[model samples]
Target chain A: MIYELLEKHKADFFVMYASSKDPNFYYAVSMKLPDPAFYAIGEDGTEILVVHEMERRRAERESRVKEIVSLSDVGFYEKVKELGVEKALAETYAEILKEHRARKILVPKEFPSFLYKQLSEHFEIEIVSNPFSKLRSVKKSWEIKEIKKASEIALNALKFFLEIVKKERRVEELRRKVELFVYEKGALAEDTIITSGKRSADPHFVGEGIIEKHVIFDIFPKIRDSGYYSDFTRTVIIEKDEEIAEMLKACVEAKNEAIKIIKEGVEAKEIHDKVCDVLESYGYKTIRQKAKEGFIHSTGHGVGLEVHEEPKIFNSEEKLKSGMVFTVEPGLYYEKVGGVRVEDLILVKKNGCEVLTKFSDYVEVIP
Target chain B: MIYELLEKHKADFFVMYASSKDPNFYYAVSMKLPDPAFYAIGEDGTEILVVHEMERRRAERESRVKEIVSLSDVGFYEKVKELGVEKALAETYAEILKEHRARKILVPKEFPSFLYKQLSEHFEIEIVSNPFSKLRSVKKSWEIKEIKKASEIALNALKFFLEIVKKERRVEELRRKVELFVYEKGALAEDTIITSGKRSADPHFVGEGIIEKHVIFDIFPKIRDSGYYSDFTRTVIIEKDEEIAEMLKACVEAKNEAIKIIKEGVEAKEIHDKVCDVLESYGYKTIRQKAKEGFIHSTGHGVGLEVHEEPKIFNSEEKLKSGMVFTVEPGLYYEKVGGVRVEDLILVKKNGCEVLTKFSDYVEVIP
Candidate 1:
């Protein structure tokens, strides 16, 4: 894979300067580093890692790369004395690459600007797309297991949400309760949107106050420190008002239509188009045709190390492949009727998709 | 302040392309943003906030910026149809600058590289240091209140740590219990380190198993969603071991020695030098002299929106000022004796420093 990326980019080596916060860098090195480190893959697929002396021991123990080098190995302190911290750091990076005899290095588009400004003087650098994103879009077996675990935690949170909606009538308190419950289950529910009534129509509003009609509970909880995320949304209709009954029906139809066509070799955008067609067929407007109301947002996005990642299921022309996972949700939002959405996580397979979500799409709530 | 920064940089306009995750951006806007937005200040001190149509309403309501504009207002749809989304976005940003007749623009060093690549075609951009970090280094009265509140919460967590260590009697479980207690107080304790015995010599190890003679508890909890953080470290002695008693004394002496010199008009590096001097006087080597065994870290650092920020208390010459908040921590580690650290939150005033930490340095556990 590393050789293929180097060949595709026409690079002598792929140099990634990033921290653990960067999902691509984390995916590449298979470890989380709080500080910046250099990870390089040579044309011959020889992987090298460069780190500070302080992190050298941990890198040797935990990093997947076999040939881990420390800055001290390259005379960092002497260089710091000669050139100062900023210049010495940049010079040391250059020295590492020079020792490898790398000429044309490829860096991700998201490379640190400061490094680019400093390193561009020594070598010809090509700013290319992050090779890891496409690679990470298709999940590994272990990664899928983690996602499935997160999904289970999320489904439990959904059940907890339903249970708490009655006792904890206030939306703010109910949100806190659901988040605490998720944390106790070894997952973190950050920014879990629990919105209701007219405010729910805004889509991103984290609402407050007593429960109202057409409440949207969108929960995307990540398993603690694993980077795998679970996303699920369900609009609970309390007291089944006639105003939003048709909107719910249309959303469910659109969601089902999108899911029906997902399989290996199918274009991802076709799913979004089908959702749009289904929603438009119900006499509702869509943003695809430049209309502001109705289905205003994109159909879905790939969910992985980052919450919204590659193979975006909107206007993408990328073919669906096995091991790709994403969300398929369709919603109808109106200021008066509020917002109604039904979402589920789907894993692409050979013939069809395995719906990772276990929760049912039941709408009516007695409370 | 804006005018002073503009004059200092000699730039026609100040532009910040950032998301809420950037503390500098959050400081400038006085609000949190989930997505990237454009913030510009003209020479006339006109603050313009540019956001997507979906966020325009919220920005107008919540953002401190007076002139809030939506992308749609700048004909984003028409440009997207003609030039595509990426180019249109860049063009619109340039369009705003052209409208202000901006000749030179100053952006923070951490500006998005991809945006820089696209926008450089239109304007001459100067990558200056983040002006907001210097401004944030000197805390406001309200900001000091938030930090003080976070400090109180951290001190309470320290007491809870004592309670849990006796009941739990295990390193890993105690770490989790302390973190959970902090979370219950509406703060997040992430990557907390509670280590014992020789393993504590590693300094950053999060250890497991029953407690040993010398155990280090370093708790840094952040107030949830507020972006304020509190850092406190205490090394507890089980049954008053004679091995690490001298080490603890040296650490406390070094910490107090650093704090003694902290006040307005003092160079931050002098405090670090004083700390190193105290430790060396006790015959302990420091990192400044290239020694790895004893004092191997910086004396302290500024604390505010980011846990570590400007006015670095290291080998630097930045002068201290009134209203600046920071930490005074000194630590010593040896393989046989284990590690000991004493850290406290501090606020610099005109004449002296305020010890924001209320917890005692008493190390005896009696367990």
Candidate 2:
């Protein structure tokens, strides 16, 4: 698969180096904390791998690569130091590419600028933003199972949050309580969005103080064991406002319409615009200041190991794929009236998409 | 302070760039989103900054630097398209440097390699791996406060864990419940090492199962609000063994002795060896496979914001300093028999060190 990506981009090799702590490194290697390593894929299917000394024994035991060069045995840094930083990096990359005898290399946009420069010195190089991201946007069966497991846990916590809702409970306190329940289910509940009342206008509002009438709880937590991530959102109204109700109804319709149109072979942007149209028709101007006020951000984004991945459901020209997992979140935000958002996870199938999270809309709050 | 560090390194200018999502970027600039931004510090204390077009507004609003240029706004890619990638990048960097009147630049090791190459082409560039790591090693007043807050919450949770001890209650179940309680306190019960009996052979053995022997409960949680971290350990012997009790006493004494010698201007490695000497005097060797299996890893490590920081209290040549917070955990692990580790947080002061976490050393598990 990596060879095909390199060929598609007309590159001789793709070189990536990352520390054990980085999530990007985890994505490339598929095994967390395997080693401080570098991976390279040649256009003709030649793959070269290098790992740190302490990690070599374990890497040999568990890694997916066919060829492994242990840095401890090879004296990698000595070679680099002797060759000079640029020449050594370039030469090392070239040695990997030479197996296939290719002349060009492709790298992710976020690849270390100096390494890219070194490669460019010896071989033609191209910067491809998120070359691997598109591959990861879609989910496999096992991936969806893990995501569902995480979602089920999150929903249970959400239900728990609803049951324990109190007028005096602050947004911060509520978020902490919900996170505790979620993490106990064996997920790292990290990025939590608890926006209340007018604060919800920020969309990513990290709420504080006593929560008012409208509260938006957006949670995207990674399941620790599997490293699969799940995202969910639901807005509850404490003091009923007619405007809030009507706006929420529009967002629901928009989300439903987007889901209906989302499937393999569909354009991502079309679904995004369709949601926007639904909001606009409901008297919420979107797009620009002259447009609607309901939805400011995109309809949704692809979610997988990372909460937000590639094949963005935005103005992006990328096409949807069968294995892709994304969210259909439609929201309405008014400065004074507050915001209302409803989100659900979707896994694109051959014909359509499956909703992963099972939760009711219009969940009435007690008092 | 940053200017002084740059001057000390003889860097005419300093460039710090990290994606907004990176915590290191947050250390330099207080932005949370992904922004392709650069901060240039000049010899004359002048600053030149560049940011992504989309993030310009937010960067300007939040960052300490205000003189910002938009990477996309200046048509940077167009330059690469015209002048060729290397020359374009070098020329662009040169222009930025000239504007700041910089002939040499210091960059963090984590900066993208391509940027490093570009800067290197125009002027001398040094891989100054975030000088702030050292600055951050020493806890500031505010940072210490955060650590204290996190410690208090963790200690409280440890007390809860001790109170809930029942021989019948599964250790794993107790671990989960205690983590939930810790999170409810608005802190991350990130990891709790609950090891019992033979499992204690592994220094980091997180205990499992319902057993009628020694169980070690090590609580290390990060205070979310303050971003400060704390660590504490208490070993409970459900069924006491004379050997285990003796080893525990020696380990506790070693920890205390190490703490007493730990003050400003002392080498960390010296302290580590001193602790090793104390353990060896009791027939316990630092090597794991010896007759009396004892301390396998280093005595402890610097603990603050990230749990593990610089001036590692191991076989390190780094000197201890005032405001440096570290852990003094010494243990004697006996294979299949049991193990005892007493850990406490220590803050190096001018004369001696202050023991921060006030927890009982001897823990007895009542059946």
Candidate 3:
């Protein structure tokens, strides 16, 4: 598929750095390597990996590439003796591209400017948007299964959190428990937002102190082995008020309305508009309506290798395609009443979307 | 400090995307944000943060910057309507720079080429090596304390692993146990290399399968609250052989040699050379001597916010300075006897270096 994409782009080779920081690198190599190394795929479908001597054997074993070359094997030391380490590395990469007879090399858009300047001096380098991003956005069936598995683990963590969220329970303690549960299951739970009362008004708040009124338990865990992620957000009501109840209902309805329109050919913006309309109809203001409160964030976002990937399901003009996995999270925030959000991982299918997250939405937890 | 650096460079402003992936971003803002947003520091020491409407409140509360500008306030929607999201973002950034009467912008060396090209069209954009990297390398007393805390957690995790590395125990299972222990303590243990037998011969191998005669357990965990990290590697022998025993002794000696020379004004390369000479004198081949096996990697690297930061101690000409913390790891690898490595985090003081990792080197785990 990458070869086809390369051919379509009229490029001789697609080059990227195998740094775990870049999801495109992992998507291309199919495995993570600690050290940043040169990875290039030739038009002839040759997957070449150039790594340091220390990481050579490991890269050979883990990377999906056919040819693995060590830096020492390619006169890297001799080059370093002449030039500095940084220049030597860039030159070595350029030499590798030259050896491949690659005149027109396609690099990721996020390629370092310094490296780009160095490589451009040698080759006809074009900064292309991550070619594999779109490909990775539309996950395979096994990828969907991996995501579902992660979602299940996250749901279980959420359930555990809900069971323990007493009136006097500290948000930090609840977060720690959730993280421990997920970690024990060989997953990583990070940036968990367990805000209560007025603190929950800020969407990105990683809450602390005693639990009160509504508690937003947003658990996003990444499965350790697969590097796949699952995001599940549920606002649990400990002592619900009339306004908070209405807000919760409106947020849930908005999320459902957006999910209902998700299919192979639906425009992402249309679904976003639907969510906004639903929220606004319930006397809630949205970012689209130029209001500071209510649903301020996007309706959803594509989730895959990275927690956030391409094909954003916000005010995007892109059309949803089959096999695309995204999160449908409609949240309502008020300065006085706190925040209520219900998020679920969804897999867009031919007919509709499959809600991978099985956890109950906004639950009233008895304190 | 960033403003001072910017002024020193004769740059009107310094700009970066506030993405957690870029340590410099977090270093400048003193906060972590999920989404990538615009951040700029002017010559007058004014720190400006432009974030999404949803993240406005959170950014205001968390970010150290006094001036927090929401994207919506900057006519982001109007700009997006005229130009695409990407172009609009760049345009808005350009507008911000123009508003500040700035014509020159200094960006990090790792800045995106695509963004550089966009910004360059409007202003003088120079890709500068992270000016803050040098500052970050020289840690404060509090930073040293944080790293020490991380080291203690990693040491605990390592001890837990040594206890569980009995015969018939899978390396993956033992690794999981170590990770779970660290995660429970609010630290992240990632890329843990627990290789046994021939697999250990590869330094970077994250091992699998049953425990053997020799196991290399390299635990590098970062503190959850403080982004500081501690890296420690110790090769344990379950049923020790003469070859493995000798290798362990040589590695320990090499590490000690490197640490002995670490002090203010000491050359990094001299320390590296000491490690190489010690390992070579023990009849082990070093990378410096152009050998495939034995002491293949650098003696050590500076450890801080990122595991591997500035002031590289491997064939580097830079001199060590006080308050700089680094790792002094030396390993010997052979196809026949697998691998043996001993590493310790050290803090360079005015007089000498203090070893931060407290775990014993080369433990013998009985089945």
How far is each candidate from the true structure, as Cα RMSD in Å?
Answer: 2.3, 5.8, 1.9
Off by over 4 Å in 3: A1-9, B1-8
Q: State the lDDT at B346 in candidate 3.
A: 94
What does candidate 2's lDDT look like per residue over B1-367, in tens digits?
Answer: 6788778988888777665554555555655554345667677867666754434544666667667676555656568557764456557667877766777788775677656655676788876656667777788898888888888987898778777876346877788778878877878874487887775765654567775577777888888775678888877878778878898888888888888898999999888888888888887877322222567666787776566666578766788889999898898776656678889998889988888898778888766
Window of ten residues with lowest summed lDDT in model 2 chain A: A287-296
Task: Give the residue spans of candidate 1 off by over 4 A.
Answer: A77-84, B75-85, B335-337
Best candidate (score: TM-score): 3
User: Would candidate 3 be rated incorrect, acceptable, medium or high by CAPRI criteria?
Assistant: high
Candidate order by TM-score, highest to lowest? 3, 1, 2
Supply the DockQ value of model 1: 0.48
TM-score between candidate 2 and the true structure: 0.78
Please compute the TM-score of chain B alone for each predicted structure, in the order given: 0.95, 0.86, 0.95
Ranking by lDDT: 3, 1, 2
Q: Give each prediction's DockQ, rounded to 2 decimals.
A: 0.48, 0.22, 0.80
Instruction: Report, in order, each candidate's fnat.
Output: 0.25, 0.25, 0.94
Cα displacement (angstroms), candidate 2, residue B169, comes to 6.1
The TM-score between candidate 1 and the true structure equals 0.94
lDDT, candidate 2, A206-298, per-residue tens: 577787777788888788767788888888777787888898899888988888988789998898889988888877877433232457667
